[model samples]
Target chain A: MLKKETYINGFSSINPIKDSGNEEDVFRCVEPDYKTYIDTIAVRRLGKIQRMALVGAKMCLENAGVNLPDAIITGTGLGCLSDTEKFLGNMLDDESGLHSPTSFIQSTHNTISGQIAIMLKCYGYNNTYSHRGLSFERALEDASLLLLENTENVMIGAVDEIPDSTLKITQKVKTFYSKSHRNEPVAGEGVHYFLLSNAKQPNSILLKEFSSIEGKVSYEEILLECKRILLSAGIETREVDALILGTNPNIDELHYQQLQNELFLNSNVLQFKNLTGESFTASGFGVVLACKFLLGQTLDERMYLKKKHSKAQTVLIYNQFKGISHSFFLLQNV
Target chain B: MPSKVYVTGLGIISAMGVGVSETLRSFSTEKTFVRHPEILKTLLKEQYPLGEVRFSNEELKSLLKINSKQSFSRTSLLALIAAKEALFSSRQKESPLGIGVISGTSVGGMDKGEYLYDGYIRKNGKFNLHDAFVHDCGDSTNKIVSYLGTQAYSTTISTACSSAANAIMLGARLIKAGKLQRVIAGGTDALTRFTLSGFRSLMILSDEYCKPFDQNRKGLNLGEGAGYIVLESEEILNKENRKPICELTGYANTCDAFHQTASSPDGNGAWLAISQALALAGLNAEEISYVNTHGTATPNNDLSESMAMKRVFGEKMPPFSSTKSFTGHTLGAAGGIEAVFSALSIRDKIIFPNLHFQDKMEETGIQPTTDFKKEVEIKHVLSNSFGFGGNNSSLVFSAC
Candidate 1:
């Protein structure tokens, strides 16, 4: 838990489903013009993930009215995937040693945050977390720590991109969704950036608390842990006006459906993976939506799993990656 | 008072040798292990010298008593071995239920992933499905947690060379914040064609023995291994009545924000990290007994770090040396390996030598401690780990 209260001042994201209107299961981010945010010449040299992260981070900082943050923290599962592949593929072909150093230089996990800092000329605390599903949560936790350490404002983000080669290789090795689900949850990639501060603002969304667990935790144990977390925050599970789960039309929802039916029966149940698809850092989009719903934004019709008609002042975002890693975030409007 | 973070145990595996005793002996005997590669099957094996661990994957696995049938990346194997040593040195009676594992690595399992992917791409060799799963940077940390058989919370940090330093920093912060009572924090990397070729392409792969802080230093020799330390809070130490090796008194991380690959001419980030870390420890500049430098032996790094040292301790400078002179610049694991060395320096009261140094740099006219010394009244040691992306971190290990 944070020693000081942390508030989400601004948030922005670039995911696949915003304006595609393709009606197909295939997904890719609706990328914006990189030149608008990044330098024109630099955009040509930037990788896809770097462009997406910079645009999202710039928009988020603008929304928060901060030109430079005290710290920059980022998280990613497969960082600079395209560049990594390029460097590796070239080596495989030539075998005469590495050719160009450009791709190799950009392939590090911290490249994104380092580039952002270079662009802003913000020589502050910079860190990157590359844990699998918990990457974004780790970044969030570090941001809260920085805020408690008296950093006025911190810029934190979660960004992951799936190149075609990565997608093909991963699909052959991993299974994200079950076959019985009506809508197959396809692989996804996106960038979500948030500006967090210890000082409250006029329209700040209070980040109450968050907790995560790893390994083989039973569904019942997960629910109990959530209950304990909420209790620690002086709130009851029943008082949670809305529950935003990482559930999609794929997989069993692994007791998430049971959670909705048994516990939050009268509360609005929401789903975001159907829109953003599945990725390690996809839970970040849940955080963005949680903030929006807390700020009086209504849920899209497609996102509703259970439509309980009421204003949502408190939202709990729960996410699990294949029953391996689980995380919960509690947010409040006040 | 805030809780103090203590180093209860230390484990390291570098080219210097395996475990603490071999490493200390290598330092005392003044022997350099940078030699031609015999294990890593890279195309440039004869071109550049490397400080590789003197064990193959099968050898390491067997040494660690791992099942022969299982497939483990060299990175994970090294990490597991070092972490096990650290856990044992900590003298824990039983499995630490609430222990946390935070690891750092630039290339997680690329040692196996490269060959597996290469075989897959060429379609001439078999593709093991299990081998494909270890591609992510988090795989090594996961391996450590599972191998320890503890229901621990773990994460991986990848800030290139400074990764393990950041891991230790985060672990200390978490302990100080009362989030966890104990943590095993460090980093591991295995020699692979990807990184070897990457550095070769960058033209920073030294063909000869790395001479850090030398006038005509060319580049660094790549090394591979793992280093980890058991960090515990004051509360846990008191309850367990354990003797601590040293205390992690201060740590700081700062970015140069100068260039993606090249460091600034002035080493602004390095200076900030060192000064802030010293400030956090509430110690004067003169209190630092020995400084473990981030000298990669590159002309740029030596010059910049020299300037930073000049700014911090002008005239009356303390004895400082780059242990990379022996370890061969372990990239992501450099911070961790150097940290274990720093702890050893405090525990044994010695300063390791900087080998293969001839002439001092013309710019700052600074030279390193060329002779190993023992029985010194060393109270504080500062270790610097700077990496690509301008990430610079410094940690202060103090004697109790």
Candidate 2:
């Protein structure tokens, strides 16, 4: 937990979901017009992940009414996979010939955050995390530390891109599948960024607490962890207006189902991957949705698992990836 | 006041050697390990000089007692070896939970991914399960965690070459923040055709041994290895009654925001990182006894770093040297390996020399210590690591 108060001042996301009205499995980002944010010549060289991240970062700052942040931290699991594969393929094919430096340069994981700093010309603290499921959480943890140290604003983002080849391999190999259960989630990717601030703004939502643990965790352990997180935030289970569970079309909905039926029985249970699909940093989309729900956005009917007679003031997001990396976030309307 | 971060143990494996003692012997004997690739099978093995680890994957697996059937990347294997030593050296009467593991790497499992890519992508060949897994950067960190038998919070940072420096910085912060009592922090990278080819394409790799801070210096020799240090909080140090090797006084990270691959001529980012780190340590320029430079021996880096050092210390510059000459530039592992070297310098009161130094550069007229010295009253050591994406990091280790 942070010693000082931190709030989500602004947030933006570019996802693959075509629309929220239907349950469609969109695997890539429904990109925005890049020329609006990035110039034409520059856009040609930028990869899909880079362009989406740049635009999302720009929109996040604009929404927060801030020009430059005190720090830029980003998280990406695969990190410009298209460029990485491109460079690797080019090298394998050519063997001895000269290879272009552009693909190699952009293939680095930090390029996302580095480019953001370059664009802003803000040379403050810059960091990038590439952990599997905890990438976004690690970046957030760093931002929380900065906030406690009195940093005013921090621009943080989590992005991952799945190339067609990568998607095909993982799908064919049943990488996402558990031996005992079926995998129902489509492989998806996107870029989600947020402007976290120590000071409260008009549209700010209080980021109460967030924590994560990695191991071969059990369902009971996750249940206890969620309760502990809620306890630390000084909120009772009944007070949680909505419980945002990171459930995809996975056959092993046992964890989510048991948590809903036992722990937060009175709260409205919801899912976000229906619109955003499942990826390493898909919990980032859940975070954005929590912020929106705190700000009184009407609950999307497509996201509901169980609707209760409660308002959307307090939201607790619980995400467990492959039963290995488990995390949670608590937000409140302030 | 924030808690003080102490270096409790050290582990390193490079062309220098496998453990701390071997590494020290190499430094004291002044034996340069630059040679052709013997362990890493590559088309450019004989074409370019490298600092390859003198062990094959099978040998490494047997040494570490890992089942050969389990497919672990060279990156994970190297990390496990180093991290295991660190954990063993740092153990007290009882092991504890909440020991965070933070690792840095540029190419996580590319050593394995490069070979499997063709088979998986083209569908013309069979994919071996052992080589198929452990491709991401986090895989190495996870391997370290499971091997150490600690249910700890772990993560991986990939900021190119400066990765291990940033990892060390983050570990210190976590200790200071009272988040974790003990943390294993460093970086690991394995040589692969992908990196060799990338540098070859850039036309920066030197055919000869690297000559850092030298006038007619060629580029750096690519090296492969892992380096790690166990950091403990003040409270843990008191409870465990363990002697600290040194104190991590300060660390700072900054981006040049200038270019992706090349640093600015003025070295603005390096300057900021150095000055800020000094300010945090509450030390003056004269208080620093030695510096471990991020001198990849590249034409641009040595010159840019020289300008930054001049701007920071002026005429009162400390005796600085680039150990990359001995270990070769281990890329992400350079920072971790150099940090261990800095701690060793403080612990033993000795300074490692820059190998193959001939002439001072004309641009800055800076000269590094060319001979190994012993019995020096070393106190504070500043180590710099600059990488691609304009990432610059400097760490200050003080004698405790």
In the range B1-400, model 1's lDDT, one tens digit per residue, is: 7799999988999888889988888887786788889999977888888999999988888888888566789899989888888888999755777789999999888888787777775564677877777888899999999888766668899999999999999999988888888999999998888998888888887899999999989999999999999999998889979899999999999999999888899989999999999999998999999999998998888888989999999896899999988889888888999999899999999998999999998889998999998999889999999989899999999999
lDDT by residue (tens digit), candidate 2, B160-250: 9999999999999988888888899999999988998888877789999999999999898999999999999999889878899999998
TM-score for chain A in each prediction = 0.94, 0.94
lDDT of 1 at A330: 92
**Whole-model lDDT per candidate:** 0.87, 0.87
**TM-score, structure 1 vs. true:** 0.97
Worst 10 residues of 2 chain A by lDDT: A175-184
Per-residue accuracy of model 2 over A1-334 as CA lDDT, tens digit each = 6778889999998987664454433367899887887775865787889889989999899889999998999988888799889999998887667798888888889989888888888778899999998899989999998888788999999898888767655655565533332465666787999999999988899889889978767788888888888888889999999899988765566888898889888998889776777787888988988987888777567788888865878999999776777789999989
What would the DockQ be for model 1? 0.76
Residue B393 in model 1: lDDT: 96
* DockQ in order: 0.76, 0.71
Candidate 1 stretches with Cα past 4 Å from truth are A20-26, A176-184, B122-125
